[model samples]
Every structure is written in structure tokens, then in C-alpha cells.
Target: MRVRTDSHGGHGWERETGGPPGRAPSAARAWARAAHPVPVLVVTGLTVCLAVSMGHSPGSAALVALAVFAGQLSVGWLNDLVDAARDARAGRLAKPVAQGRLAPASVAGMVLGSALLATGLTALCGRRAALAHLLALVSAWVYDLGVKATAWSVLPYLVSFGLLPGVVTFALPGSPAPPPWLVVSGALLGCAAHFVNTLPDLADDARVGVRGLPHRLGAAGSRVAAALALLGSALALAGAARLGGALGLLALAAAALTTVAGLLWLGSGRGGVRLAFPTVLLVAALEMGLLLTAGLPSGAAG
Candidate 1:
């Protein structure tokens, strides 16, 4: 069989089978990879910590963590499911969904189950919190459903992330809505995430017709904008004494280096160096976790 051309126009023999020749992924591995386990685990840890910091009991924190994990799982799978066709066209065999290593039926089943569990857990928080969370999930779904190709792509991120602080706080036994600062700051970071998250895929994304905000910005522009937004968020949190000095400095330095690395990679089109994008985004997510924890008003927790 002739190997398809991958994104780089290389003969995609290594990618043609979703693994090296004669080494197809097992069902479990396929599901795991398709769901993007790393980010889900990181977010789960952060959610647990943020829940505890907000004065929730340990049990509540764990429940919150589980809920968030399931939701993230659902979203991750949904993203792959929605993008499978495009990814296949781009010869992105690293993705289990597009490479057919995982059956779409299995992923669809996982999505339904995970989404239901997420909804049930959110409902446990409160009616209002559940409502907000559903809207947030809906926004994510909207992004996956083709809005990501349009100028309106960032809107979903804005809506979902802006509502996150409210979702967290309102889940408190009797807490009121989150303050506007938290919402606005979160929206900014979320917007930044849209930029940074798309950088590694910019070339392929454009080829596959995904012209989101980052695509419009191009790689270098996206990197710089992402860094600025991340740094701005750090500054916003720090100015209010929300971010402690150590985390703030760490975040700032990481964001700066991440942008620089991306710019270099964009200029050179190197392979190994492209790994910087996801690594830096992981660091930025930690910063986001700190911000989430900081925005919570302690008095509100029951």
C-alpha cells in the first residue's frame, strides 16, 4: 500500500497504521490516547486542589475532581471525534480517532457516559452550578461542532472559561456568583489558551480548514499573543495579591520562554523543538489552577 502524505509531505508509513508497522494500538491504549490523558490528569489534580482551597471538605474536593475529570474526558474525546475526519485528511495518525485505532462507536459510548456522569456530579453541587456547567460544556461542544473554523471560535472559550469561576464558587453551599474580576481574568487566559493550544497545529489546521483565531494570527503572532495574555493574567492575579510571588514569577518566566521557543520553532520548522508548545501550555495550566484557587473567597464556603 502506498503511504499517504503526512502534514510535512513525508511518506507517512510510520503514521499510516496509527503505530509503527505491525504494531497497532490495543483497544485500551487507543481509548487512552484518544482521550488525551495527560491534560485530563493535570486538570484533575488542579481541580482537587482548587476545591480544597475553596474550603470544601476533602470529600467534596474529591467529588469535584472526579466530576471535572469526567467532563474533561468527555470534552477530549468529543474533540477527537469531531476532528477525526479533518485529522485523517491531514494524515494525523498520531491521533487514535483519525487513524482508526479506536472505533468511533467506542468513543461515542465513552462520551455519552462521561457526559452523563459529569452532569450528575454537577447536579450534586446545586441547580445553579449545574446550569452554569452545562452551559460551559455546551460552549465546548459548540467549538468542536465547527465554530472552531470561524472567527467566532474564541467566543466559546470566552463563554466557557468566563463561567468557570462562577461554576466553582456557586457550588459552594451558599456562595454567591464569582466576582467580575475572576470571570474576566479567566476569559483572558482562556482566550490565550485558544491561541497557544493551536500553534503546534497551525499549519495542519489551516490545511484542514480550521481557521480559528490562532490560524488568523499565524504561528508567531499566536505565540506572542498567547504569552501576553498569559502574562497579563498573571499580572492581574498578582496585583490583587492573588498569586503568590513564587508561582507568579514561575508563570511569567515560563510564559516568556514558551513564546520565544514557539517563535523559534515557527521560524525553523524543526520537529523535536515543536514539543515546547504542549509543555509550556501544561505550565500555563498550572498557573490557571493557581488563579482559580486564588479567586475563591474563603468566607463563601460552608
Candidate 2:
């Protein structure tokens, strides 16, 4: 069936009942699409970085890694759930059920299952970590429900991202509570994420009344906000390094490079399609690198 064209940049595919000529989206394909593996992969990478940076025990590290996967799954599935109508209207091939490859009911089931898994696993981490995980889920839901459309779209990111490192560290046996600087730095990175996440869909979002901080700022303003976030994060990390040592410096450098690269991408002549995916990829990388920095030996980092 035909539907309105996507105002944002995403692939266009015709919805057919018979399925793509010879191709099929089986249980594996459905799972992949439902899981939205990219974000999960990025989060996993971040967990590793954190483990190395902090010299976490293997068991603790494993739990944190699992938390990342569970967290991303919750985020990804919820995104699809909230956007299902929009995807239907836009005839979005990028979405699982929207392309007629999977059923909406099935996707909903996946969301429920994943969220339950996340909650159970998080509880094992500790009361504090579990609370953080719950907070992240709540923040995401708030964003989906219309907080994101308000001035508060940024709040969800701040709360959610800030809690991440703490949750990981909390999982460790006998480790001190997460440092204030790490959480603060994470909040700063969240601000950047708010901008970067909204880049590709600004147009479609506007078209469908999904205006958030990015829409309010417009493209130029959004880009500026993104750059400033990077700068601010870098400065914070640099200061952190002064107090904490070499790993801080390396983290700051990584944050700087990440911000610069994002700004460069935004400024490029390339259309949103080409730019958005890469930007997302870079943002994920930056987060992972920052987390990993804590593990690098002074000499190795230098």
C-alpha cells in the first residue's frame, strides 16, 4: 500500500502482503528489526570502555554489559512502539512491521519482553543501579509521551545518560559509588545527544508535529547547540583530568574530536541521509571511547 512519503531521510520501500519477491524476514529478521541492534551494539561498546577505564572485575563488567543491551532494547522497542503510527503514515520501510515484514502485535510483545528483561537484570546490579535503569526507562517514556516535544526533551537524555556510568560502576563489587564528575560529564554528553539524535528527522518531525529542541532552534541553531555541547563536555573532561589524571585528558580529547566531527558532518553539503547515520555512529563511538578511556594505562594513553 502507498502512504505519505517520509519527510525525514530514510529508505523507501513498497509495502506488500506477499513479501519481497524472494526475500523473507524470518524469526531472526524480525528479532533483528525489533531489537534495533545498532544502539545496543553502541551501548555494549560503552560498557566495555567503562570496565577498562575503571579496572572493573569481570563479573561486574559482564553485568554492566548485559544492562547496556537490556537498556538499548527497551529504548529501541519503545521508539518503534511510539512511532508506529508515524511509520505507517510515512510508509517507512525502515521499521519492521511498517514494511509488512513483521506484525505490530509481535513487535509490541517484543517490547514488553525486553523491558521486563531489562528490569530483572538491573535489579541484580543494586538498588541504586536499578533505580537508575528505571529512571532511564521512565525518561524515555516521558520523551515519547510529549516531554520531548517540550523544552524538556533534553531532560530525558540528561537523566538517562548521567545514570549510565553510575549503574555500570554500581554493579561492581566493593567499588566506591560513581564519581560526581562522571555523572555530570554524562549529563553534558546527553545534551549533545539531544541535538544529534534529532538531526535526521527534523523535517518529518516538523511535518508531523514532532518539534523538539532541534525544531525550535532550526538547523543552524541545532548545529550550534551540538557544537557547544561538545565544547562544554571537553572542557569538563579536561578539568576532570587535571584532578583525576591522564585518563581524563584522553577522554577530553576524545570528546573534543567527537564534537568537532559532528559539527563538521552537520556543516557538510551532504544531505541528512548520509550525515545522520554517520553522526549516530560517531556519537556512539564517542561515548564508548570516553568510557574506555578510564581503563587506558597512563603510558598507553600518552
Candidate 3:
């Protein structure tokens, strides 16, 4: 998020101005400076939720977070690297890579090392878990590489999020898939994320020749899709929570109401409400994840 500003007041990947000096490797080594950590944290938080929901040990939760961090870091860095030129062209100042504050080589090195570490950590989680999580990572990479320009971009998010619950469940001794509702709700949440996240970038992306689903849908269509997806996720969570009695149902209702309130609040785009839409959906997704955990079998071991 720390962009090196160009004379044109844009990120400077297309220009040499404000770029880190070639000899100053130290500049590229700063973790906080080289990349935006918000998305990484969000993804890693989901991994932690997975471990906890599956009744895994604390160590497992930490390990899951670490593995997810690696994969998210690699994919996120790749996104920046691959889109540096496009971002510069779009005058985006939010990408460190596009700003030239971060060296592509350094970011690429991090990607390689983190991906290898992610593989090992996921393997430690168990072979089935490893495969599922790795597939999720691959799906992300596919989006970063070439899929983002196509209408099929939503496919990766669906694949990855659906596989995520399996990753957690399969890490146990029996290697079970998560309940059907869990997978369905998770995928819906992810699909909603695709719409919501892409809505802000639709114009910029289309300008840069990236005609993903959001671009094709246009602003209004994308918003409708995102809203519908979120509502569907809420219903799925509510259904899953029904078996747990009134308390669980109450929680689910609360989450749904929150989602509705968010939609209404976002309608006004009051102050920063529009900017908070993604975060609101993320919280709802986390609530849905918690509801999914309610049905986890007692035998699922730490």
C-alpha cells in the first residue's frame, strides 16, 4: 500500500522516478514496505478459523495460519508482479510493486520460498489436507496468471473456498470432507467476495483489458450478484445452524440482519461505508464458518 509516487501523482512502475535505488537492497527487504498485508491477514484468519472449527489443537491452528500465510503471500505478490504494468497504466497508487517501491525480483524470491514452505506446512497438516490446500493455492495462481481476464475468474474462488472446508476436515485422522452445507456456504461466501472485491476494480480492470465477470456484469449487475450471493450464504448458514437449537439460530439471524444492515448502510455510501463492504462480508463469512463448525463431529481429534 506504500506506493512510490511518480511526478504524475501515480504509482511509478512505468517511470524510473522514485524507484528504489538498484544498489539499496535494504529498501526491498522491508516487509511492511514491500507488500500490502491486509488481504494476507484476511486469508490467514480464515485458515485459523478452519483449524479451530475442526477442533484441531492450538498448534494446528498456528500451523494452518502459517501455511495459509505463505500461500496467500505468494499469490498476492504474484498478482502485483503480473499486474505491475497494468496498474501503472491505470494510475493505481495502492500497489507497491506498481509504485516501484518493491523490487520484482525480491517479491519473486519471497513467492518461491513461501510457496515451498506452504507445501511443507500443508503436508504436515496431513496428505489429504495438503492436496486440498495446495489445490486452493493453485486456483489462486491460475486467477493471477491468466484467468482474471476471462469470465471464468469466479471459478477459482469457488474451487478454492469449497476446498477450504475439506482441507480442515481432512486434516483429522479420518480425512473426511466437510458437511455439504459447509462446502456450499463457503463457496457462496467466496463467490460473493469475488463480486464485491471486483466491483471496485471493474472499470480499471476493463480499461486494462481484464474482462472478468465483474467487468462483463457492469457495476449494477455486479452489485446485485454480490448481494444475492451474500444473502444465499446467510441462508445456508442459517440452515446449518438450525440443528443446534435456538441459540445457534439466533446467532445466524443476527449475522443475516448484520448483512442486511450492511447492504442498507452501503446504499448510502456514507463516509466510508462503501469502502467497508468487503470487510462486512468477510465478517459474515467468518460467522458462517463458525456455524459450520457447530456440526463438527465430536470424534474429530486435536
Candidate 4:
């Protein structure tokens, strides 16, 4: 993902440099600029994986990506809007709107429009996909509204990831059913992401009273959580693949090994965001690859 610089840097810096207090509108504008597009990237990536795994046509995949992006855009906007105060307090220089670069009302309007578009596009995927997206949307809203501040922050990430595979499955033209293992893998991926993603901001979050799962657990706890979640996901995938057919066990094993390698790297104190985020992204891409290659003729060996 590209770095989204918060627009508040200039004005915020000026204020902190002994200028007058910044206006709320400046903060909101900055927040909007910073928080936008995050959903598009994450949602689009997941949709692409689904399209590949389900063997959807390019056009169909693009449409699904659009819908997913819209949904996530709505979710991301609300997240920043609701957390503006907290972000401001936390000295989150990365949030443009929160730092006073855009208006909250304008951002809300954008979110509403995007949500409407998402709802319409979801219908094209059929009722199943729409329902799944609805559930995920609600979960995301809950997470942003106040859930992230509680012990349940991790729950949203897990649910979001789990729903992603389902979204891909249902968005296909035919009745494509995602394997139970795939869903489990998505959940595990989400859990790992939750832990690793929070590592960089744990200190800032704690200072701002955002005691999320990572903040509560601390760095060590977060690492342990990432390890357990990834391992569990691998076990589930392996078991499911073995049961589905003995041929894919090797693929599952490879995924497990890759996950273990990543965990080892993360365990090393030297690992940073550049290492962790890319590692997780690669692992996710590999899982999606395994799902796509499940029925293809291959010579992959454990």
C-alpha cells in the first residue's frame, strides 16, 4: 500500500510550533484526505484474489472489485470520521482530515454516495454476496464506532477477512461455494493482520486512550497472537485440503512452511513494518494462489 501522508502536517506543525489552535474544519479536511483510498486498496486486492480463485472473467472481476471498493470506502470514511478526536489527540500526523485538511460533512457525503453505489453493485453479485457484504459492513461500522476501543477490536479484522473469501465466492456468476478451509484461512489472515498492523501504532494508540487488542496485549502479546493465528490458519487449510483430496497436501504444507518462516522473521526484534506488512501480503497472495490452483494439474510437492 502507498503511504498516505496526513494533510495536517503543515497546519498541525505550525500550531504545535506555537501558533494558535487549529480549527475543527482543518482537522476534518486533513482526516478525509488521509483516510480515503485505504478501503479501495484493501477491498480491491481481496476482490482480485477472489476473482482469480473463482475463475471469474475479467469484466466480472472488475465489477466485483468496484463493489468491494465502494463498501470498504464507506467503512474507511466512517472509521476516520468517528475517530477524528482520538486521532487528533494521538498526534496522528498521517490523517489528513483529522489534522484539519477537509470537512467532515463533505466526507460524510462522499461515504453516503459510495455506500449507495456499493449497495447497487452488490445486487449484481446476487443476494448471497450482498448479504455477506452487509454483514461485513455492519461489523466494520461497529469496529470503528467504538469496538476498536474495547477488547473486540480484533474481532472486526477476523470477521472482515473471513467475509472476504465469501464475498469472492458469491460474487461469481455461478453458484461457487468457498471451501470451509478458505473461510478459516481468511479469518486467520485477518487475525494475523490485526496483530501485525497494530505494532507500529501501539504507543500512539495507548497515549490517545485507544486500548485496542494490541494495545492491551503489548508488543509481545501481539507477536504471539500473530504466530498462533497464522499457525492455526495453516492447520485448518492443511486439514481441509487433505480431506478434499490428498493431492493438495503438499501445497498446504508449503503454505504452512511459508507462514512459519514469516513468524520466525517477525519474532526477530529487527523486523519492522516493511518486513511485516509485505510478509503478510505475500502470505495472503500465496493462500489465494493455493485456492486458485486447487483443481489445476500440477506437480507441487510438500
lDDT of 4 by residue, 37-104 (tens): 64458658867866765677788778878888888888888877787777777767666546654456
- Clashes within 3 Å, all models in order: 0, 5, 0, 18
TM-score of each: 0.79, 0.79, 0.82, 0.79
| CA displacement after TM-score superposition, residue 299 of candidate 3 (Å) | 3.1
Q: Model 3, 136: alpha-carbon shift in Å? A: 0.4
* C-alpha lDDT score of every prediction, in listed order: 0.70, 0.66, 0.72, 0.70
Q: For candidate 1, write residues 126-234 as lDDT tens digits.
A: 8887888789888987888889999888898889878776667767878567766666766766777677667678888989888988789777677677666666655
Please give, for residues 136-229, the per-residue lDDT of candidate 2 as tens digits. 7788767766787776688888888777777776666553466676677777767876786677677777776677888898777777777777
Quick one: ranking by lDDT, best first? 3, 1, 4, 2
How far off is residue 103 in model 1, in Å? Answer: 2.0
TM-score, cand. 4: 0.79
lDDT of 3 by residue, 127-244 (tens): 9989998999999899999898898989998998888778777777677767777687778778878877776676678888999987888766666676677777767766764346
